[model samples]
Target: MRWSAGWHGSAGSDRRPAGGRTVPGLREVWTCGWPEARVRAVGDGPVALAVIGECGADDAQLRDALPVVRAEGWRALTRWPGSYLVIARSGETLAVIGDLAGQHPVYYRTDAAGTWWSTAASALAALDGAPVDVTALAAHLAFGQPDVLAERSLFRDVQRVPGGHLLLVGPGGVAVEPYEPAAYAPVGLREQAPVVRAALAEAVAARIDDRPVSADLAGLDSTTLACLAAQRGPVAAVTFADERLRDDDLAFAARTAATVPGLAHHPVPGAPGTVYYAGLDDLPGLPLTDAPNAYVVTASIKRAVLDTVAGNTPGPGVHFTGAAGDAVLSAPSSYLADLLRERRHRRAWQHALGHARLRHTSSFAVLSRARPASRVDLAGAWWQTAAELRRPVRDWIPQAQRPLAWTPLLASADWMTPDVRGLLADAVDEAAGALSDAPARLSDWSDRQDLARVGANTSGWRALALAGHGIELAAPFLDNEVIRACLAVPADERGAPGQYKPLLDAAFTGTGVLPGFVLARSTKGGFNALAYAGLRDNAPVLRELLGPSSHLAALGLVTEQPVADALARAAAGQPTAQGALHLVVAAEVWLRQLAAAPATWWEEVSGRVAAA
Candidate 1:
């Protein structure tokens, strides 16, 4: 719920005119939920800079970055370790820089008076009471990709600045400028491992300070973080163990805790209520996230873990999650397409065989799918996907088995109505027409898009943790430096089969930080059983939520009868539209909460209101 907003014009000018002489100055911006200590400002009056969030920069660095950013643009201020937002004012020009990841997104709206910007799109939308943009929401639900319509926010008239970009507002006008490239120059995994290790260590170190640090020890990424944090001091490592899950995560967690010193293992046993969709009955209690967050469906389990950490730590604490580890550390099998594009046929076949073995399919099937992707550029792929969306819905296929594309349409795309599908297809076509500077390789573009998706959702999870438990959630894997270090390595090697998170293994092995057992572990646990159980138990509530009166259905996005049928199939333990339903339900919940949201994000001063 933390946000900050400012403007480059005199819409809300605080200065009174002396003798009918209007002062030409920028209005004072407003903020909420930001502590004074976390807020850092340098310079004064017209030319100044301010940073809000968990920034690792001091006054010296801020003073250094201000002039550099003015001369070099927004990229100069992005070298810091932690995630943060930078607002710089150089004379009449102002720049707002968001992180490489969408964890800290920037949204703005421009008009005759001036341009207004904020960290929260909803806040900007509230200035004009903008309604939901159906096409954007349709694209979000159907594609599940972040950059499809990168500039469109969920609320109409509130424009979003894409990740790795900055919003520059000056006397001339407002413009969105890219500060970073979609992909970095290729580096071998071996050469990049040490750099990644250093970046990750710094990212983790940035979060560790006076606060009590706790981490999730359920998988390799979180385990690495827990071990790293343990080096600093004691860390409360939590593993949510539910008998219904029947996973080996708890066993591995216990072994790691026993071996790794300074890690006090606290296993939180899951109750029947600790399942996905467990808390949907009380919609008002949920935090109003700025976008549709998948974590809303599984907040019960997250809350359970947070409650355990809260019980152990007496005061405010920092929780580390391995949110974007898979996105950054490992590439998808889509890297096989990148291999085929490079004419590395032998390597492509070998990797395809490995992936086929993992999926229990023929290698030819994997190669055939990747071959088509190799032949098509990003725009062509989007065009083909738009054509498919315009046609009838296809049968449900597991997302992992889908063919590699620029943006693979998920099973959720099948859940929308025909009209909505057409709208989404048109939007996709428009986005394809606008795709001029896409990354040359599929893996490069897809990797950044994947990171953006995970980063955005993790921001929602951070908000949930903060609002519900007074805790700060940190994801070191999504830091700008860590992303640059890891993604610079070629995707094929980073996602090379036969090794799990090869980048992490190479970085931490022989370093004596993460244990050999953890680095060697290949199998990761699944929460399918818990998800199904939650769906079965909460059928009535879901039926009511996605029924005819649902907000999503009211918007003509989801068909009411089909959603009800899907819920019935889910409750009966059949192959159903669980993923799609989660998106629909989450969007529905978000819409409901948005209607009830208060306009407390801004405060009116001296009867002068800032127009959004």
Candidate 2:
């Protein structure tokens, strides 16, 4: 909730450490529930502490841990869980650290005098005095992630700290030390499975017992958690009852919860209207074009579910969700590449095909298609794919040197193989160099390391932001133990025959945590088509907000002729799942939000467009 930006004049121009001299140009502020947040600065060069809100148990633990942290000579130690920004200076060094999970944004830069940092990226842009880059905007408009992170954001000189990392800026140069996950060693699949399963059950049990918490019981992940928790005590299992979200397995949620004696199953129906408008008032300035609306939709669902539960409760409440369940627990083909190395051949083909789809989806698709087969064409495609892979680099770079750099060092780091062991030797060396002054090894192959590296880099930032409203994300499959064990199992055994998540199913067989039908069901639901139907039903709102001259028509976000043809085909009872409708609805909702608040363009537009 707190937002502020400024600069303290240069006090020194020294490069090397002058034994405990105070550094200059650092600022931080916090604004919400963290009432105990305090800042004490006396005989120092440049040091500031700003606390935003009331500290919960987790934050209190961090706060109590800080004196010990400062005693260790650490310029900054931020252990709080809520949104925050901490910038401090000791000598010529300026240390800036946001929440490890990236819920809060802190932008920084270093130059001739010293370093300057702020909570908002745009604030840095305005301070540095640069124009917003339009090419980056075009790329954002075309693909969700930028074509290459080498391109700075529209607001010049501004850069986002990659989630789960800290920034150290000094006269020498700027360095980033990425947080690492703690590694759990390998064991045989059979030997590891039970332990992993038991740990997950334990985690779930502890969470359910924490308070009168309600867990989102979607068909897959949380339902498993609910089944396990229900055996111990009463916990609320919640789900949306919209026909679009109902999927064929909505009944499975009820059936599974019913198996747990005395558990309450709460099903909230998806409300009518665009569903976008209902949530638009809360999130103003969401980009109208070139981004998905999933954030708003999920936020709306979370708000409604929690509000209903709060209405029946007496005080502050805790809610649980399965947001990271899919990413953490379920192995997406891309994230699990190292574990399933045997499928390397098929994976090669899939990656090739995926690359082709991306190529064809872009504006250059037509040009590429018109060209005949040749080595040059093949090489062009390869370079383009590689470029696309490095699109997130800009977010990693600091405020200075953003536009001047052609090499995308940060993006390259992100696309490094998920398994740290497989990282190229040079990259490993570079990472080690960055973490040399850090407290511990940065390249370890552990769960904590993975959580800090892979999880934060990929979905950790997204998850942290969503957890703000007393909601917790549960991912059984992503359980660190389960993943480590799954990784240890040989490829043939893990993927034996026709099963995905083979080892996982075996581990949970006797756990009594999932119904048979739900366990056996492989195909999941897609509420996108339903989302589209809802948006189409509220076409009047779309017209009103978008001025009937919406880019959905102009830029061919949706093709006019194809729309008419598809509708005709659908009316003839043709089986049209039309998943694009979901994307459109999300986009429309975002557009409406932007229409409401046009000033906060970068905050809303940047993320929606940059998301993977």
TM-score of 2: 0.57
Which candidate leads the pack in lDDT? 1
- Candidate 1 lDDT over 251-339, as tens digits, reads 99999999999999999999989988999999777888889888999999999999999988868799999989999999888988888
Candidate 1 has a TM-score of 0.95
Model 2's alpha-carbon lDDT is: 0.42
* Best model per TM-score: 1
**Model 2 clashes, total count:** 26
- How far does residue 388 in candidate 2 sit from its true spot (Å)? 10
What residue pairs are clashing in model 1? none
lDDT per model, in order? 0.85, 0.42
Badly placed stretches (over 4 Å) of model 1 are 10-27, 44-46, 608-612
**Error at 282, model 2, angstroms:** 9.5
